[model samples]
Target: MRMPTRILLGCDFSSAPTKRKNIVVAVGARQAEDAVRLSALHRFSSLDDWSAWLAAQSAWVGGFDLPFGLPRELVETLHWPGQWAALMAHYGQLERSEIRRQFSGFCASRPAGGKFAHRATDGPAGSSPSMKWVNPPVAWMLHAGVPRLLAIGAHFPAHQPIPERTPPRIALEAYPGLLARQLIGRTSYKSDEAGRQTIERRQAREQMLTALLEGRTELGLKLDIDTAQANALVEDGSGDALDAVLCLVQAAWALRHQDTPGPGYGLPPDIDPVEGWILCAKRP
Candidate 1:
């Protein structure tokens, strides 16, 4: 029998226990005539707990909604260590408020045009503004998530502080919204806030789910869910099931390019921990 491909998706992450609420969905893969069969989801509460689960799995792909790197100019201006490890260390030493203050001060000192030093490709990708505190805080996510990925031995690009001895693991930066947008352009499928959920929004989410399964979206990929099952996942309100399905789609996308010569995934050599990769899977 062919071994199953395990896939994980992490959402709403934080560095401390008070901010411990997040969702992790583990997916298992199977082969079918028309599409890939993905198993049910496994949820987790903490990154450390998720790390323990990751150690036990074999081949897998993950979609993490976290930034992989900080802007190099910010690092240079702040006089923090240039290397990834040293930068992470400096970040770890400061409290959240201290870090925010330092970043805000850095922004204040720069000229208006260069107020937020960005990665080279940020403009093309329509990613979050580098200096924004919320709605995709790339800097904070890098500070919070990358160290854990490295500690687990995942292989990311040079800009991350990964240990030399970590496993042959491949880390990809993923944004669930990328796929969600393709399904339903700028529609809100879910919200953690109670007041934001509405019947029309739920119907739109269901349509998005239908589009994913029918391969009607521009993702250039197909999902294996039937209508009934897809509706159930969308109606769950938490978006965990839909998120897991999205991870499965990401895993599928990775599998097609897993055999590329270098990093195995199409990850850039200087993958900013502030950006995400769609990891490639290697054949066993």
Candidate 2:
């Protein structure tokens, strides 16, 4: 079976997608070996629509800004299944309220400050705990996102890779901040609130755009977008569009460097399946 050459996607996901805060998807591909082509920036106004679209699509590798698993410590303490697939299936069957109640009880027993347990990947990826239900609400995102990936029959390279599937629709747990931080270094680039979208933030976005277009990062591949397109990406003060693009860059990097094997597409070799590592996350 002939695989689809260079197909990639970057998704800036939301747990509860609304019209005011949509999920942004950047569809892209490689062109001329060194150029990354961003074909579209699609905004899904609702989770239902996003899930439907994800299920209907195939033949691309995507970097999703969502946690793939919970901390093993938390799961074991709670006496859930130790296996990855069994745990996910068990987790997928519960209602949101049930999950919240269970996680909340776990936190209540622990001390203040660091109440929740974290996955090994959290430190390097700079990601919130998969069990964190508020603020970023990553728990809800896992509740919404993972089941859909399973339903779509997408291949999570970290979790499972079926060799027989042609033109594989591979999914990797991706965090855009991992790459964006490399360029901007603690600078804020986006705000969901229009009033909070300051000039400095806009400049940060511009800096990121320029960096990607010029191949300034470790990724080595430059964008194939026109000047106008590049400007448009920076103009979105919310940063969702740029985030999707950043994830696309990560996927593109993984695609270009096929030899960086292991489930993580450059992640550590002994990555925990129950606590999956993010793509490009280096071992501590």
Candidate 3:
């Protein structure tokens, strides 16, 4: 029997999206066992608009570039609800200011250089702690992103069983930086500030794109894009477009493993319920 074609999505998210910095989503489908075709790129300037778009999709496996859950240690230390659903409920109700205050306090009480609580997957994925509010502001990303996923009732296989639907809408946590690092090895490929979008970063982006097109990465899947799409990914100095494509690739990888035994979707079997795992991240 032939395998079914699966819709794949990669998202480069912004916690507080705006006209200047919108959330970018790359939509594509697997063309073969080792290839993905880029179909379109969608940009959302508001969370509600993005949420609506996600709800309308009937079936897709998305790799979202946002922390899905807070660190287990942080949740326990803050005395938040331990269960995934309840913790998201409590977290979604809080204002951003309160979250910043509480997280700041948590960091201040701990020793420097070891202040942020980490998820088990963070080490292998090289992701920042979800409790961190600044720098990358992933705390805000979690606060904004996870609630939307929950509201949409998407399937999170690592945290729970697949929903009994004809075709499930699946969301997997993804970190684009993890994939980018595999190609560039810490080279900065994008920057939001115009002053920082130097020639070096552009070259790095070009190099990474070349590798993806040439199927040189460890994922063993080649990206198929037209010249226009390729140019757009490189021209957008913010790197949102490229990051979205990276997430799309990860989603493709997850789709390939969806039927595998155990956790399916390349997620670890022992993934934390309250602190979800990043898809495609190696178990540590």
Using lDDT as the measure, which candidate wins? 3
Please rank every candidate by TM-score, starting with the best.
3, 2, 1
Question: What are the C-alpha RMSDs, in order, of all predicted structures?
Answer: 5.1, 1.8, 2.2
Model 3 over residues 24-130: C-alpha lDDT tens digits?
99999998799999999999999999999988887789999998888889899999999888888899999999998999899899997898999898999999998
Candidate 2's TM-score:
0.93
Q: Judging by TM-score, tell me the better candidate of 2 and 3.
A: 3
Native-to-model Cα distance after best TM-score fit, residue 180 in candidate 2, in Å = 1.0
Q: By descending lDDT, how would the candidates be arranged?
A: 3, 2, 1
Compare the candidates by TM-score and give the number of the best one: 3
Residue clash pairs of candidate 2 = none
- Clashes in predicted model 3: 1
Clashes of each: 11, 0, 1
Model 2 residue 135 CA deviation (Å) reads 1.3
lDDT for each residue of candidate 1 in 134-221, tens digit (9 for 90 to 100) = 6656666666676777677666543454444333455665556667777787877886666776887788778877787677754456
